[model samples]
Target chain A: MSATTLTIQRVSPDAIARVIDDAPLEPFGLTDAHRRALAARLGAITTDHHRRLDSWLVERGGRVAARFAWSPLAARRLLGSGGFRRALRGRAASIRDGVRDEIEDLLARAASGRAHRGSLGDWLAHRHPAELALVQASAVEWARILAETGATVTGDWTVASADAYYDVERARTTLRARRDLLVLDGEVVVRVRAGGPTPSAGPGLRADLAAAAFAHPDGRAPRRYVGIWPDAGVILAVDGTLANVRAGTRDLVRATIALHRQGELRAA
Target chain B: MTPTTTPARSILEDLRGDRSERPPRDIETAAGLRATLDAELLAIRSVPARTSPLVISASDVTHHGDAVDITHATSGRLRGALIGQLIRLVAVGHEIIDPFDDALRAWRLDSPSPTLIAAYADLDANGRARLATDVAAHAASLRRALADVPSAWAVRTAVRARVPLAGGVVVLHDVVDLVVGSYCDASSSTVLLDVTTSPIGRSATSLLGFHAFVHCLRTSVVPLRVAIFSTATGELISRDVDETWLELAANDVLDVARRA
Candidate 1:
């Protein structure tokens, strides 16, 4: 781990394009040992109690509510889905039209009893037009920001969905991870943020990458993680190496302890 | 009272420059301007390390009109805040039903102010009626001036740009009311519009320049123009973003930083 080097670059949008395009393809071979090691580390933390940890919990420091609410997370879920890709591809007159069509489809699904209650579709159905307009506006801005990064839905690039890893011994303890987009069959992971870079961004991103590795079905870790902050016009690319993943695992453990302390305080 | 005669053109039409006239793309010039501002700001000792950074807004650079006692909410301030929300609704082409209610709902959506809500609750029947009348008049004026913004231009409301300088010690923040068009690398095409309830004042130009400056630094693409529309008097003022305006804005920021 000491011999491995972790590369992180903070650059402009255009330069980030080059960074993503010019990333070195490193060989990643993850065996059951690696998966077992990660699981063991997480399971050790949740041994005392059941815990569901995700990048948000590890990075932002909070408890995940039992129910979904209207927040940027919902927007992110839509942005990183195939439905949004289809919406973008539609020959709509305007971005708002595309978004409206997407919402209408969701409404139809909800009417047909396909969508779960308290989901984005269910929640949006009860919202006012003014609120929906705001959603449309968000979709438009996100689309524009993504386009500025020279990222397209075509080729090997596909929107990545959230992945979860449950503890073998503790079924209640799970680790969920998600990235905005991935390409080269999950070798490269991309996450888009709303604002500027922060002091905690690097560690947070590393933890995300680590969670992705733990939850990956093939037990393979990504080679790179690219974070794009459109509002701040900054991009961060971090290499995924064994040493870095170990460091990220440490971050996750610390965050889990902190969360447990908070929960204990609430109980007290 | 509403204007006796309708204007020949809407405020959006007046501010939306010719689509054929593409501003020249000078990435070098933009980069140089940003470098200059960064250097000037980096030299300032406005905020010390391990301390909360100083945030400079347009109001910090120039006089923000006559000061009112903020401890107590005034009808004028409430009207202004509502009008601002109404402009946001209009920018997104939301249907305006019951100007006062729509404005209040929009305002609460963006910022839920308990004090303002309490203030509104305290308003007597006559006072509430007068406030509603004023908001309706302002809504009419806004509608008359803004007309219908085409959805194709991708209008964004309350677009905020916060550019940190001097290693995050000093942050320049500004929010443009309405942004039209997209950022083009080949040429400048984005237009920023600021909606004000009051008549255009002397500091309007400075505010516009400050917005343009912060936007350029944030997006790295210089906007084509920055315009301000006054719903109070149906006045519109727009200026093409040039090196001069950006320099002036930088100086204004430096002045504020020096004072800090």
Candidate 2:
């Protein structure tokens, strides 16, 4: 077929997942090229370093991560004095304190555009496999859950190439969110693990909600955040309470820094 | 390939011909057997989902033997996943190198044993040497089986099956090691194979039977044959899924359900 006359067919991610879950003997039936494509795309797609650190924070603070993160008392006090942007900026401080230098160093490097992936890989190389496995396995199972529920996405949720943008309504600042999976009823931000003591909602989902709130022109945000373990088939959902968001943002800031410390931003 | 049959062949081909070794399916007897099987299925479905789904695996049905054997057998399973990756590559037509190098490369991006790459990296020289030799040998055995596999056959690896019972309250679930060809019970259109790293410390034939039974339940069709490849000894045990064979599998499934 002529290139102009040929119509390109794009399979939606949901369609791809549906085919997999429903069909018992599909892989063998598809063309080799399609099978390879599906295989490559298989597994949990969300499990970024920043997300993992937020997960780590969920471990440290447990419920406190939400109480202090969603809308911290201090951030609220700052908001009374300044605009929403200033309050948001104020929220940054609580998070930066625990992990400032690492954040500045890594974010600056990413901003400089040295080699974000190299940064990601160096960090992954040092991490124990269990952590990565937990992240990946959980991601895979979460995908299965999404398919089972017949959830659909309005935008591309593909990782590796996706750039999530979270806008701060008050400050007009945009926070980039690269989450694993986002279910957009009111946005269920999922962070999955294969094996781990299932902690309650972590900083990753909270930060996502925080970003969504700031980004929304209407100031509307995702209502819930999730921490999932696929192997255990366990899910921990925490509501988007203001206090939890404040704590989550705080954890998010620290995680942003930790990822920088963890990653190496140089060419392979 | 999945459990589907083509119209070109007959589902009852095995039972219809006088050339068959297994006894023919007698309609009257089969009718009675079907009722009994359905009753077992209903009994299985009777258990509440809260009491854990009535799921059983080929391994669960297989005799694992005594403790020392069990320990050895268990450890061997840990490597099956890693080795299975190589077999998968072979299935998809990849040229495999030495076990260590190919495994290191293929598993770098994706592997169930997420830390295996690092664990391999952490190994001392002798440890590394031992691992490489063992993996390379196993890889060679799997490749031999692949060579025997028809290129035209559809090869599905690590195929997961959940045969819902009692209307989804209970399930008979398993991850079939590998399934080849398309399948339908009437036609015996598909072939299923399971690969083990070590020699059979236990009679893996029952495991194959479980695989056959699950396939039949998941897709109302019987597989033509179920086989097991012992990579350690390069031994393959295969059984044709006759009506009699499938009936025995039904009995086994019911046995588990009755105990449950």
Candidate 3:
């Protein structure tokens, strides 16, 4: 499988802007055949056989899934919440100073019969001052990194959705699309990770690129896919090219096939 | 009588140092040290490959006295862990609401150990009260030390540095309790601070060196200084990072790696 070239660098905090700005501007256009193949491959993995494939089940894959808790960790949830996005929209100084208040508001909302059991708000509602401090500290670090990106404080960035594709016949199984933050009107796709780059980071990021392409509204992938690891002080960028997206698709297909075979084996 | 200086104030003064003193950025030294350590470490017998890399932490280097039983959760160990969590809380500007409750909450959030949880649960009311009182005292000490971390310093708590060496054969992991300043600064301005529940000892100093060494390996920039504040006895120990200090740290790691 042909993979997109990956560039990994240990970037200082101040240099993050240059890395994002320097990302390649090549457009990634998908043909009718590509779309059909993606749909068929995704459909084959669905558990159900009779339901139509509708709506996207979007998710952040690779390190994002491993690092961010889909379950109980309140700090990770707060980082990816709508509240965090709103905080980003406010004055930068307010974000640094008022993180605790934001957390308190989230906890209050969770306690007031608004949040479901085991939700982000529920988990936060039970947290003590020390745990809240972790959330606050994480926010401070995140704000510092975002400030270095040189992006406008207002509506330049928005959280991307995780899309799911189900089998047309049976609606039981679903294939979720991997994505995270969409910046500059989806010109650049960003995945915020926790740690440093690893041996599998290249393929994982390509999978992210493929997932983003599959969910693109225009059938055109973003010009660049960027992975930022704030803790490790590193950034990885991959141009959203045809070969790279194809490689990512191949990865997803292979993974799905393996899972499908496993399910069948279990049943037999 | 003159007013007594608090440990936290002393640490802050030492950390601030001479404002006009700007340490030169020595990337070449860091690179050389990393190359030497890499060559020496790879030359040692490699551990058998496994699914996960073998991790080497500061405890691995410092704990040479007695073989700590992995299964037992001692009160001292629990107190240390609890105090460490509280220090992180104070560093982030969180006032300690209830010391024991906050520490346990932070600990659970970070890593919930069933063994530790069961141990804490088994404690009687009096035992639990004593623990809480101890935690409150430690929290007070920590609050004083970390309360004034200037926002401009860009204080980051629980800053972890994981340096995987020998093609991921062994990973050196260390977490600085607090970091002041940024690596992106023009001068050598980054300062690594560690908070310990126990008094600073010989082992603690060595651990500080180990932290500096691993940090340099990860960031390619040596921090200006490394400091440690002990909540146990209100003691502060600090040392500047230099080529000689890094060399000693590299040698210590080599010695430990060879033994392993």
**CA lDDT scores, all candidates in order:** 0.68, 0.45, 0.65
RMSD of each candidate? 4.2, 18.3, 5.3
- List, residue by residue over B211-238, the lDDT tens digit for candidate 1: 8888877766778888887777777778
Q: Candidate 3 on A1-268: residue-level lDDT in tens?
A: 4556887765443344555577677667877677777666667675534322111111122111223353223354345333345555663344446455666677888978898886666777776656768667766655544443323222367655343232312224333444456677777877666666676677667776776676665567777777776545567877888888887777766665555565577689
Off by over 4 Å in 2: A1-268, B1-38, B41-51, B64-74, B104-128, B148-152, B184-187
Q: Candidate 3: which docking quality band?
A: acceptable
Sorted on lDDT, highest at the top, how do the candidates line up?
Answer: 1, 3, 2
TM-score of chain A of each: 0.81, 0.36, 0.73
Which candidate's DockQ is highest?
1
Weakest 10 consecutive residues, lDDT, candidate 1 chain B?
B64-73
Error of 2 at B257 (Å): 3.1
The numbered model that scores best in TM-score is 1
Candidate ranking (TM-score, best to worst): 1, 3, 2
Q: List each candidate's DockQ score.
A: 0.35, 0.03, 0.33
The alpha-carbon deviation from the true structure for residue A210 of candidate 1, after best TM-score superposition, in angstroms, is 1.4
| lDDT string, candidate 2, A1-268, tens digits | 1111101111222332332222222111113342233223221222232232234443444222333321111221121122212212454232112122222333456566653464532333333333223222222222333322223334333221132464322222235543445443334454434332222334545555555454444444445544443222234444555555455555655554443444434223
lDDT of 3 at B84: 73
Clashing pairs in 1: none
lDDT of 3: 0.65
